[model samples]
Target: MKRLLEFLGFLAVLQGVMGLVHEFADWNVGVVGRIGFLDGYEVYASVALLALGGALFAVAESRRSA
Candidate 1:
């Protein structure tokens, strides 16, 4: 669970960063436009994924400490 959380957290952070870069910087690293993926939706998805990842990480740490 801990490993899974860590991995998920990292991926979420990466997704957020990518979204930011694609939205503000106008630089799509992956098949964003080619695959018909929109940055407008990415921003919201990024927030949700990041929040979920953070919560998972916190829960994992708390469990480890307990």
Candidate 2:
């Protein structure tokens, strides 16, 4: 539960950062740059992922350890 959420959150954050770096630096990194449908919306998606990761962290923090 908590661990799973934390892990997912970490992944999301990593991808989000990667996406943003890819966009700004044109480093050819992250999945956002590889997706054809997300051509013009990479930044938005990256930001969304970052938000989702934060929310997931918040939820994980509010949970009790089993």
Candidate 3:
């Protein structure tokens, strides 16, 4: 379960990053709506993913040391 969470976290982070880029990037030209709601969602997902990834990384590190 922990490993699975870690994997998910990584995916979330990726999604978030993509969202942020899309939201912030000046690629709003010639596009309808001017802003993608998905990008906003990505930002939220990224934060969650980062947190989970951090926890997983810590656990793995501790196990390796042990």
Candidate 4:
């Protein structure tokens, strides 16, 4: 579970970064609309993803430290 959270957190961070870039440039390498089915809410969705990812990462860290 910890590993899964870590991986998901990492992926979400990466996707959020991509979404931010795509939001500005419209690059769209096929991941922009997929995250939370973001659609036109890319900016907000990306921010939310980043927040979720951060929380997940924190959980993973606690799990690891324990």
TM-score top scorer: 2
TM-scores for every predicted model: 0.69, 0.95, 0.43, 0.78
User: What is the TM-score of candidate 3?
Assistant: 0.43
Q: Write candidate 2's Cα lDDT for 12-34 as tens digits.
A: 98999999999999898898779
Q: Judged by TM-score relative to the true structure, which candidate is superior, 1 or 2?
A: 2
Which sections of candidate 1 miss by over 4 Å?
A: 30-39
Per-residue CA lDDT of model 1 for 20-66, tens digit only, reads 56766878653332334653576676666668778877867776632
Candidate 3 Cα lDDT to native = 0.52
State each model's CA lDDT, in order: 0.66, 0.94, 0.52, 0.81
Give the per-residue lDDT of model 4 (tens digit) for 1-66.
888999999998888787788888878743766666566798888787788889989999889533
The Cα RMSD in angstroms, rounded to one decimal, for candidate 1 relative to the true structure is: 3.1
Off by over 4 Å in 2: none
Two-way lDDT contest, 1 vs 3, winner: 1
> Which residue pairs collide in model 3, if any?
none
Best by lDDT: 2
Worst 10 residues of 4 by lDDT: 29-38
Candidate 3, residues 1-50, lDDT tens digits: the string is: 55655566566555545545655684432222234564445545545555
Candidate 3 weakest lDDT stretch, 10 residues: 26-35
Clashes of 3: 0
Pairs with steric clashes in candidate 2 = none
